[model samples]
Target: MWTPNVNTFFQIFLKNFKTRKTDDFSATRNSLCVTIEAVRKFTTKRRKTSVLSKKSKAIGFIIMSAFGFAMMAAFIRLAGDLPFTQKTFFRNLVAVAVAAVVLCREKVGFKWEKGNLPLLIIRATCGTLGIFCNYYAIDHLVLADANILNKMSPFFAIIFSLILLKERASVFQYAAVLAAFGSSMLIIKPGFSSATFPAIIGLLGGMGAGAAYTCVRALSRKGEKSARIVFFFSMFSTLVCVPFMITDYHPMTWGQFFCLIGAGASAALGQFGVTLAYANAPAKEISVFDYTQVIFSAVLGFFLFGQLPDGWSVLGYLLICGISVAVFFYNRNLERKGQ
Candidate 1:
């Protein structure tokens, strides 16, 4: 199983979920898509496994991860009127099926250490709630808005880590976190706004994401491998969601089915790419690169859905991005000074 960074996973998953609406495709496109995805699984595995320069591979992985996630969001949007339960089912089902094959091929054990089982369960549970909140936020808010709120996970992660893991928080980190929260409020603009409720919901979703990611980080420190962590969580997410699947099941058209499949395939590719990217280099070096997802999402929102960020929202985006970049550089400077 993979020792995964669930943030990269959700950042791609939930942000895009709120963006594109999917279209009904012709039979030809559906068939072609299935065929392409079958090939893609093989390609994704080889691509991740192949030898390459670390930075080059990490950058390549991050780019592909963003693109794959963008595609997943488009498919989710295209799924049209499907029950969220059903959609979640298909999204996670496809991801697990593909990721399972990768884990087996990589010779990674799926068995958990009895001692670490609790951590795995906690991580999976948090991850599942994160997904649920992500969908809710996506359904309720504008795509761009939903995504911006979801990205607040990083800020929340710091807090969660400080509280739950008893990790030390730097003064600089606290300041950046405050800036991020302030920026989020600019996007929320709560007074006299109908969006206020969902904005709050979106913030909770971000909290869920942060908690989930912090759990994964703790799990990572327990000497768990990435695939192992991911495999267990994916399986857990699929199984726990079964009741929702049974109770809220909706019949899907072939187009919807294929779109979900495509979404899964894209997520699978992203899962592999992101896992590889961070594995290859220190996160400080490559983590900022993933922020390109915001740009990709902005472009996607505009072209695909005719949506764009408002001026203050754009300023909010800039604030969050600026603080994140600053935090990265500041952390890097600290590391250099310490060295």
Candidate 2:
């Protein structure tokens, strides 16, 4: 019942102050955690959106590439009865000019990575042969048929990668390759007839292109420049074709000459479009869209040349495209799991 002790009062005040400070610190920490979580969510959503946008752009570029290649095939058909070598020469001539300009602009000079020369020669030889075969198919078969046949290159690429790049394939990849070959037989209708010859040649074209692609992959791994690679292939093809073109020279009408030029330009468009596409996204993500070339070729063939694929050919197309779609999905699934 006497006056309160000063020390007792002071100690009570100090305890209350300590409790208040601790509460404030806990509240602040909770608020900071919440803010961090919100920031993380916002950044994750932005990253997902960015990936989707890039994929969309890649798809668009691939579709453009498909149309360009289809148009190039149509122009080759329109050129009419020209030797495949002659057509190849003109096509490579345009590529050479374009590649030269690119190199000069970049100031990369004409230098190549050492030990790349052999692969370059192989790539050029195979590319030249592939073009010759493809041109022959375009001349002989309907445009859709020729284009679909050439589309077999990706499957052939898998096989070549196994042999040349020492890459191992999954069981699914091997099965897909077999399925693709079976599908090609439906289009080819294997026989000794002259009608089947072009289809066979078209298959060879796909194989050659696959081999050339493998060589290109090897060159790229060795740090070779893409423009230099293109320039070398174009120059090699042009020089090789010169002798054949001179021997089998057939003067072209202005119409035919212009058609060939259109073919060359269209091919360039296709090359650049595909390059842009792969640059933006991985091949597995967008490669399936490349089958659109068959669709474009079909439409062009029907309208321009009044050509229609037979039932067997249509079946082949469906099967091949289905396999591609399946592989594409499988790859996406694996990528998602890895992530």
Candidate 3:
């Protein structure tokens, strides 16, 4: 869970080789022994690479998390079969109840800063609208496709950091952002009517979430617990969404109620995992790994929903993945130098 400095990867990589060298040599014979031993050691070394291990575990976590999130989307899609406002309202209402129980059990109390009130309200508004777009988008598109587009939030975060936070932009970060956007375009094929407005809404959802993240980052320094922030969001979203739900009310079947429960639980889980990730690792260190959500979405889409990314979409996915990884290392290296 620790985000290793650049030196950590090098040290770990070298240590693995040294530790395996003897066993590696024993497996080989006379003339080609040395070469084979070296190759064996190298292979083993790469296989045990800290970078690869961190990335693999990070990606795995994301895949599991994304599956839950995708299911949430599927629930939203089903809910969309009714009215969007009504569905969204119920979803947020359930989410509020769920979050409240968790917060109560944990004794997570909130002490609102007078200065942070406006920011809190703003973030809550953004969160509500973001959820609206996300639910609306998934209703019109495949759950996996909508998710793939939604995963672009990190790219937007990187860009916004540069513009708003005045954070230094490394070439790799720029490349990662470009890759993310390019891949998204490939996946959705912007301006194509075949993909239509829902795709754009999905993209907007990413932007909205991206803005929410930026606000989270901004308020993070103000010493608020992430859970408290999430709690507030759920509370406010429930409040705002309730009025709309009553006007557009529709009776729900038990199946739909179950789906709503599942969506709330999964979303809460994913949000907690994300918060834990930041607690365990730096934002930039963990941010790039988020792109793995797309890979997960693509695979899940194909298997669960019979949705597949086209060749162009595949290419874009690769670009996004490559750049995001590059940015991770770039940031890690910077962190190593105490930047």
Candidate 4:
């Protein structure tokens, strides 16, 4: 990665110019040009290597995030028959504790920037609702199905960003969205059956998550700290769940209690992993890797719950994942051309 300094280059050029005759001036100038070109090539190569290294790290972090989320979903399913709200409370309770510790360690006071309160509320509200729907889905649907449905948040985020943030999407992105929606129908398999209800709710949960993520993007752009945003959402969700949790509280055995705790910890791992991932690289680069959660969930479901997705569900997974891969490569190609 090292290259000749500008000063050093000039010094060499001047020395060559002084040592050579007037007839050799052209040769000296050409030599300097060659040196400059070499340096440029070296630096460009180093930069590309650095970027590749960062993308590698981002992929690893995102994969870890996927596994963390899959584990969280599995733990939720393992918690047995309990109120979704009650489970949500425990999840956020752990988040609140973790967020509080982070804030304390960072010495960042819990203060929202003025005019950001409304967006914070929106983020928390949507996030709480999303969690409720997701927990319910985990309780009712197959674990992999629930995981894949929730993973639809990114596409939903695109739509919400367009609406809320006034961001414009390209034709390919919109096409990807449409293809994703059509693919999701393969899993939803809409009908007048009781089973389909949870799938619909799961879809709505993905939409809520997308909306919440959209708000988070806005807040981040407005200079909100990640820790504060997480703390606010965790606290807000915890309080929102209090009343329902109290009223419909089901007694949990020690095992179930620990399972919920495990869910919360795994969720925190996912949250932090994703945060680190995107910090290293843009979503377009690493987001497709998040689909790994579906595979992880499928493995867990099969071994633990004897759950296996049927043929249609498998088709849905392939289409959705394929669409994501296409979108990812399309975005990368555009970036390369722009560069």
Q: Provide the overall lDDT of each model, using Cα atoms, as 2-decimal numbers.
A: 0.68, 0.74, 0.64, 0.76
The number of the candidate with the highest TM-score is: 4
lDDT of 1: 0.68
- Deviation from truth (RMSD, Å), model 4: 4.7
lDDT string, candidate 2, 198-290, tens digits? 999998998887777667767776778878887898899889999998789899999999998888878777765665564555443455567
Q: Which order, best to worst by lDDT?
A: 4, 2, 1, 3
Candidate 3 local lDDT, residue 241: 72
lDDT digits (tens) for residues 149-248 of candidate 4: 7878878776777787777777776776667666656665544335789988888899988787678768877877777888898899999999998789
Candidate 1 local lDDT, 294-339, one digit each (tens): 5566666789889777898688778867876686567556544542
Clashes found in each candidate (C-alpha, N, C closer than 3 A): 12, 0, 0, 0
Q: After superposition, how far is residue 284 of candidate 4 from its true place, in Å?
A: 5.7
Candidate 3 local Cα displacement, residue 299, angstroms: 3.0
Candidate 3 RMSD to the correct structure: 10.4
On lDDT, who's better, 1 or 3? Answer: 1
Model 4's number of clashes is 0
- List TM-score per model, in order: 0.68, 0.69, 0.69, 0.74
